[model samples]
Target: MSTHPQSQRRLHAKGFYDEFPRKGGTASRATHYCAGCGHGLLHKLIAEAMHDFGLQDRAILISPVGCAVFGYYYFDCGNVQAAHGRAPAVGAALARCLPEAVVLSYQGDGDLGSIGLNQTLQAANRGERMAVFFVNNAVYGMTGGQMAPTTLAGQKTVTTPNGRDVETTGHPLHLCELINTLPAPVYIERCLLTTPANIQKARRAVRKAMEIQRDRRGYAFVEFLSPCPTNLHLSPLDAAKFVDEEMAREFPPGCLRDRTAEVAARPAPPPLEPLTPADIEAVLDKCVAVPAPPGLDPDFGTIRIKMAGFGGQGVLSYGMMVAGAGLADGRHVSWFPSYGPEQRGGTANCSAVISGSAIGSPVLSHLQVLVAFNQPALDRFARDVEADGLILYDSCLAEKPTTTTARALGVPASRLAIEAGLPKAANTAMLAALACSGACRVASERFSDMLAQTFAGKPALIAANRRVFAAATEWCQANLRPE
Candidate 1:
């Protein structure tokens, strides 16, 4: 090796990998960004700061969905790639969980200023300890040249071919100005990346934000007005000139808020003590008020059930009861509910999964069982049942459902509930019908215990619901085949 002076030899930042293996190929030494994208420059500044502050091991960089999503390929520190516009939220989680670590949220204009605006503002408002690097290129760089929230008026993009219409699309969002209005942020600055002097200023701003993170100071936001040559249909030199002349006119670069000197460093959170199995059990028992039972047999397999009806029809309650029974039987269970805005008359549905083993997902596509309380529910979800699945509908409906794949049975659930003097217990009647059909492998004793636990406060209605359930069971046993 040539013995060159330390200052004369150029070296890569310590925070970055020696070679980007994720890029793969002979060009692994190069970045994936276009010729004049500002992401490369910003990445260099961040990596250098991480190296200088000795924060490489403690840094957790959150990369948002955009051109910079490949940040994990270069940054050697902890990296988390968030969904489109969710970097700030993910950063908040990391900041809370790993309070000792420095969290950085790197986002583009389209990702942060548009879809992630709420998460960004909320994190800043809550004074989350994280550095937010907002690269404002004024256009969506990843998914073609779309008009971003920060796109200036009259700026031409693929979505706005004839220049942006102020009347239809509104003016560009001034993110720095908006963030400055919030009180929790410790430091906020907007820097331009154009001329040599401006680039140096931006470098300082990036370092200052990292310093706040190093000190564990509250929210720090640094916005960079960067160039996007390919998207702007301009040469690299022209793009730099465009950012210096035109973009700077709209978004003047300067320190908007600086409380770093006034704010005290946040005290590190106390170390968390590990909890033993007995401690965890005690906590769960206290919180859930239920004792853990032995798990069901492996032969039980997995059962997917869906219940649907009007909002006030206790559809969600039916799913919960099924899930609770599964829990009491010592089986893995999941309940997912979906409903419309209107609480009473609107439609509602819920999916419940019971399995002898661990459950992968709660959402069911083709269900083993579908319980429909109304004609609309039957019409909507009847065809979703599997070939050997079972469909139980309220016999009170005026129309009969047509299905060739599954066995459809109509039970007088509403009439049975009314006869039992509990009109709202139709869902309980349907549950009883399901139990009698043997589609679910839960013990009958567990179902009874679940009912008692569900209605422990209402002593009067328990007997009535049990009557309704027994009537539904008898009707199903006599009329329907237990296929």
Candidate 2:
């Protein structure tokens, strides 16, 4: 009779498991961990906590390797994979970078102890505002079973064939004991999962730590003594008993320390203010379109142009320069690419749309101008030109000529650069030629202004490129087009 009776579950063969939410969140993917793993149980508890506390949006999970590396695969939150044992450090940096975000560092014993001890201790000492969920099973289950830093003495593991040694090996480091010593630690508890009752207790601790994070409290750490039956060479039931009798003795179930008073002693963080309308107006970055000249006929549609060459040929900058020239002329402009596998040490190509109306997409369509700087580039984009559209290519064309009806202008860019006494200014030379060609709507004064804006900071390079532009414009007016 009740419409909202309870939270529903889609039952699988093993029974009803928590259904992963398919909604708007950073982590919307299903997990891929093995069966009977503690991670899924813990993930469910954490997700429920985040969902209940309404801190889902501000939460970021820092996943470290071992079992919890793929914690990002389930938690519907902003997730980042931290380096092994470095989740604390990652958590610290994230807390510092975006302090508003509630950082959760999830790590295993191998990740936190064997390799990441320094990072863990340092982060704890720093009083970094983060919540750490450490699943300690006393063995590294990921890369074959090996004795971990928390492995109890006389525990027979793969690495410790004759069982652990108390003298030569040294005593197992107690993380709860170590973290308890740190002044900034808000909470530290060594919880176990040997029994269903204890699982509930651990879950409560987990929820409490998260609640602290929700209230903007300082550092909180909860270590779960998870079961690893496969690595421990015990049946599931036997492993549960081993954890209860053996593991629980060494790692007693109690609170190491609580600094909630310090949290209460501190003043609450300031609330965020609303954004004003004027502030919104000032922040908008509007890119004005290029305009047409005073004397030129405005009948022609905006001219689209393409520039292509090897990686160092300055195709992107050249295209931007041409587009900037159009911008100065008061026309709308957009620049994009036709780049392929040639992008890596091979040729590069860019297309620019200089139009009177707003551009739909920045992708260069077929039947526009084609400017190719290499043989492959010319060969690749030659036939795609429109009947009236112009084709500009460097004299460095080392391939067979195309007989396309589109008007073609071949400027010996390399020769022009050599004559100009600066070789790298070749692309700038080709750019100037395109400007003087009657096809584009950009005015001469704006073109010069654009050249200044495009190369404003570099004076020597600007002078060199200016020579190239001037020379190319002179050559185009003299030989290729009628003024």
Predicted model with the maximum TM-score = 1
Give the range where candidate 1 is weakest over 10 consecutive residues by summed lDDT: 1-10
Query: Whole-model lDDT, candidate 2?
Result: 0.75
What is the Å distance of residue 178 in model 1 from its true position?
0.1
TM-score of each: 0.58, 0.52
The per-model lDDT (C-alpha) reads: 0.86, 0.75
Q: How much does candidate 2 score in TM-score?
A: 0.52
lDDT of 1 by residue, 181-232 (tens): 8899999999987788998999999899999999998899999999999889
Backbone clashes for every candidate come to 0, 7
- Per-candidate RMSD vs. true structure? 16.2, 16.6
Candidate 1 stretches with Cα past 4 Å from truth are 1-11, 274-483
**lDDT minimum window of 10 residues, candidate 2:** 7-16
